[model samples]
Target: MINPPALTLRRRSEELFNSAERERPHKEDSAALLLFYAVECGLKSIYMLRNNLRSTDDERANAQSARSFSHNIVNLMIALNISRVSIRPAPPIVIARSGLSGHPLVLHEAWRYGEKVKDANTIYDWLASLIDWCRKNR
Candidate 1:
């Protein structure tokens, strides 16, 4: 049987996060990239499920509403109609960028290059936790 896109995305997100958490050499960048993807996909998956969407195609067909929010985590949470307090770990988007102090997760595409995140462990932990919570709630 085919799994739903939400499940698929969450699963992949978990897999990548696990790999990133291992901290292997030369893998940090890719891991970070995937980790961000994991969160993005996880959020989208939940959003799609809540919006009565089933497949990626379903999301694509509604691209304006579904695909558009894939990049920014802050927007995804808002589009999901989720309040800041409702989300655990208080996603980076909700955190003050000044506090993050150059953390890539706060900046657009900064996390793509693990070096920019500064505290990858914290970001990873937060993202992993967020994905877990979002997936469970969805």
Candidate 2:
């Protein structure tokens, strides 16, 4: 498990929030992005568990628990921010497809403004770029 620097997390979060504000015109998009960001943070917490847990079993359990908790958090955030619409379960594929490999924090921004992103590339290319950026910046 790798511990991303605190500065990186703060910068990533700020960037995501700023980007979401700029690109998210629809309420649903904004909600989705917010939810995605919460999930990303939750995942980070789970990732951190790997460093402290003693056994693989504990690590796996922690990861699953963190994901469940994050899902709930996302739902709550969505409900709070965007009223009048029931939160829908987004498939993992859809969430994963949104170029979230690196800087998981970017998932929020992407969720909100991914459609506006004009960089045309295969999913692999997009993911690769994100991973590279994470490595360089981290």
Candidate 3:
């Protein structure tokens, strides 16, 4: 039986982030959604690597009931015990909107629903920093 490595998610996240970067000039809204997924996958990779959940079997066997692998990047970051001070800071709007699950920095729900993200470039840089952090930590 072949099992997938935890780093697979990191690779996919990087691909998505890079694609988003290329699309940013022509399609900012699309890029925003891609950034959300990139952040989500990066955070998950961090969780999987940290917990040794390398395969589905490993995850099933060792998964903690309290931890969730959801699209909420904030919760995933919390689960991974990431230090906020280590990464670049999010813009003021993102910080103020952090509590909302639908916020662009949190998830893709806002972009999917056709809502425009304010300070999107700042958010993009923050997410890119997060992906970089994941790469370093993983």
Candidate 4:
């Protein structure tokens, strides 16, 4: 099971993304939301995959891959919102310790944008794109 801090970050990130999606415009907002969602999914996938690995396999191998993937995903999310502020602290240590930094949705947003982009153009577009992505992905 994921820890409270990590889980809270995920839920908060999802909520922020959802809020952005509903109130914002389209395109960029959707992309931002989708990017976060993808990262979140990728993080979860890596965790499940790692847990299923053979006991004889090196856990570090799976951890490394998951870490790299998560880092990239977080970077993408940051790029999507250059003006946001982070609600959480550095890289969200809880998730990173679990090799799930790629899924630090809340950390990225809170650290980057948080509630700062309440009336930004990019946020609007990101929200719209998020809705479309959610429909297709779902």
Candidate 5:
């Protein structure tokens, strides 16, 4: 796996976020998928930046410890010491295989398979919140 630099990851998240915004009107599922990835990249960027991981080699060394996060945004946020209270009002987005009861599944791999997604607008808002938080912290 290519563990990109923090700046690269942040840039990717921004690009994906813009793409998600464009796709929202015509293709919600696509937007959700893009939002999921955008949040993932954003979180990872913040994590790396906070941890003082600037070089590709530094990212690779830490990549093993971060591998568990994968596409799990909740886990990544927790690892970054980000609490729900920190980015409140807007909930964190989770890209999961199955919707865990109680925690509303807003985005999932089903979107990648052309499945319709629910509450995509809310997810987009959540991404905005996360991006804001990353900016403040970075």
Candidate 6:
């Protein structure tokens, strides 16, 4: 199976992006979480579509699409753009996710309002960029 319509993925992204926008001012933590999912799903959907793969329950397909599941947004972006990175600094240098599974930095709380995530802009921007790319190709 290959190249599902991806309507579900797009809808999910829209839902999460909408939720994040609505709650950004007061509930940045939860909003960031939603935005994170939005981008990840968007990227996976795009990547799968480009690769002639299905968006479904197949284990291999899921694993391929979700190769960057454990990464933070920055590392996730880096992983998505894997071909661009050349220098391998160290363990924390986070170049990709499929092989190394780089650990997320404590730069922000995953699901909590902490001092680290004072602003949701970074998360929002990343999500927005992913969504924009999806619009063009997915």
Residue runs of model 4 more than 4 Å from their true location after superposition: 1-9, 26-38, 41-61, 70-138
Best by lDDT: 3
Q: Model 2 over residues 49-122: C-alpha lDDT tens digits?
A: 43343322233432332333343433423322422223232223234454434333344456455542222223
Q: What is the per-residue lDDT of model 1 for residues 9-113, given as tens digits with 9 covering 90 to 100? A: 767777766776675356654665676777777787888777767665565454444565647776776677666555555424322333445333354465443
Off by over 4 Å in 1: 1-4, 24-30, 57-64, 86-108, 113-115
lDDT of 1: 0.61
Residue 136 C-alpha lDDT in model 6: 62
* Pairs of colliding residues, candidate 2: none
Each prediction's whole-model lDDT (CA)? 0.61, 0.38, 0.70, 0.38, 0.69, 0.53
Best by TM-score: 3
lDDT of 4 at 13: 44
Superior by lDDT: candidate 5 or candidate 6: 5
Output the TM-score of candidate 2.
0.28
User: By TM-score, how accurate is candidate 3?
Assistant: 0.77
- TM-scores for all candidates: the values are 0.64, 0.28, 0.77, 0.28, 0.75, 0.57
**Candidate 5: residue 42 lDDT (0-100):** 83
Which regions of candidate 3 fall more than 4 Å away from where they truly are?
Answer: 1-5, 56-67, 92-106
For every candidate in turn, the CA RMSD to the true structure comes to 5.5, 12.8, 4.5, 12.3, 4.0, 8.0
Instruction: Report residue 132 deviation for candidate 6 (angstroms).
Output: 2.2
TM-score of 4: 0.28
lDDT of 3 by residue, 1-138 (tens): 544455777787899999998899998878878877888877777777777776523655655421255566777777777788978886644322343423434437667776666777787788888888887887
State the number of backbone clashes in model 6.
0
Ranking by TM-score: 3, 5, 1, 6, 4, 2
